[model samples]
Target: MKRDERSIRVLLIEDNPGDALLVEEYLEEYILRPDLKHVERFQKAKPLITDGNENYDIILLDLTLPDISKEQLIENIKHLAVEYPVVILTGYSDLEFAVKSLSMGVSDYLVKDTISSLVLYKSVLYSIERHRFIRSLRESEKRYMDLFQLSPAPMWVYDPETNAILDVNEAAINHYGYSKEEFLGMTQSALCVKDSNEDAAEKIEALGSASDRTIQSHRKKNGTIINVEIINNYIYFKACKRVIVLATDVTEKLAHLEAIELQNKQLREIAWMQSHVVRAPVSRLMGIIDLMKTGELDMAEKEQMLDFIFSSAEELDEIIRDISAKSEEAFSDLNKEK
Candidate 1:
């Protein structure tokens, strides 16, 4: 037989020899070749459960055992750290006891006289499947919880309609200078500068309209404002649709970019001025000097013209030097600030 075709292992805890035989016979007749291990008392089952030598998928536990009462027997078996599903086999049809056993984590309760062989097989299958599902759900929830709390960025869940803060992570508490309890009491409006309330509201409205992330400014508890890029989406939390906001502080990054843009603009302006404005006057003086050297006029006129050309050249050179000095000083100040 294939691995899946192999018989299911069952641990039968029954003190009555006749009932044990009946259970064995029922499994043989109705269940498809189940492997059954019979234990006459709860004490005998203890070692098997603790040692983990036997791998049983289900346990058919007699509620009233000679060695231990129904409650005590279930509690002791639980301490053995076995995770197999347990179905209580009760001789009496006690609804209260059945409910109590279920509350104590018993997978299912079966009254021996009432439940047919088919019903018993179905109950066992259903109980095992249900227990597996419950365990899987708990493990998934734990993983999500770990990621939610341990993330580096500030994250929160808030009710969009009521504008109530529902949840916050550790990064938010640290960044905003507020405790998790304090942040819960405050709305998004409370985290905005008084003057920026309208801006904040408009941004929030835009977020609600689109399913994409957005950038906005937020104010901290200490009155310090920060530029944050928030990635928000709608989710159903606690039976209601809410907004999940994952915000990262981008204040310093934006500031650096803006500063770089301003510096580039200033450098372009200086380059334009140097290439056009300062060069034009210097070129004119050089042309005048070349004319003076050719000796194209009288001595007196030539001397006067030469003096005029030299003075003009001196003035042009002074102007160019002044421009260069000013440009260098401005760039130097920028570098110092950097």
Candidate 2:
């Protein structure tokens, strides 16, 4: 089979054998030979539709069939849970009927007498193409929706002039503690703290000017404030210019930084005490011992001083070791925290 001529399994429901043969001949004569299946009545088509063994790409239905009304036949085929494009083939030339068929979910309508091989091929191709396009659009939309809903950070789009939220994702709704509908109804000003010095108008204008990310604080629903890093850019949606703001809550992160700074200050004080105040007495004792060893005293004084020197030296050694251990431990703790 050619690429475009891959057998398009077609279910043709027409009581007229001549009409069925004509359709088959058209299929074979055309450059695209669609694999055709003939069902003389709606009753016969029902099994093909329900069996699950046969897969038809398109259903060509004749409205004036003996077994069932066009509407009933279409509905019964749909009830079989088979999803394929159906084109209505009718002898009736009533414009109202054609419109009704379209409204009833028929993909296209063709007048039986005017049908040609080119028309048949084109109609099938156009219907299949259209169906594929619609399916693609729906799948793309679903994927976008899933990602938006499952995002870890808050995201929103708003009208800058009114400061009104136009749209918010699921994360935004959860983070702000508001329903999706409620969030959309809220204005940006409402999310700003009452005592905030940040001007809402100025911020909005700045947001419009921003090419990518900006940081700001937002008020939560419970009247608490949160620091948010906002990424904003201009977007044209439905012919309306709007700003899309993607906000990440960083209040906890800021608090963590502050806590780390406090810890660092305390650690510095401990290190200073061990290095200077605690080491000063030990240094003085060492100096006294050095003077005795340099023969700066008489024998009797030296003997008495030797005992003092040894005692002082032992005391200094213990203090020095203790200070060293404490300093090492403090540094290790600091490293762990970092």
- Give the candidate number with the greatest lDDT: 1
lDDT of 1 by residue, 1-338 (tens): 22224477889999999889988776665566688999999889978876778888888988778898766775764643237788888867566686677766788888889777677777878887887887788788888767778888998888888778989989889998888998899887666543223344444445363434455778888888887777777888668999888887766766655555566776777787788877876777777678877867788987787787777778777867877776776677567556
The runs of at least 3 residues in candidate 1 whose Cα sits more than 4 Å from the true structure, single-residue gaps closed, are: 1-4, 11-21, 30-56, 65-84, 100-106, 194-212, 221-223, 293-338
Estimate, for each residue in 197-294, the C-alpha lDDT of model 2 and write its tens digit: 23432444353644344457787778778877677778886789998777877566555555566667767866787788667766766777788668
lDDT (Cα atoms) of all candidates against the true structure: 0.75, 0.73
RMSD, each candidate, Å? 5.3, 7.4
Write out the backbone clash pairs for model 1. none
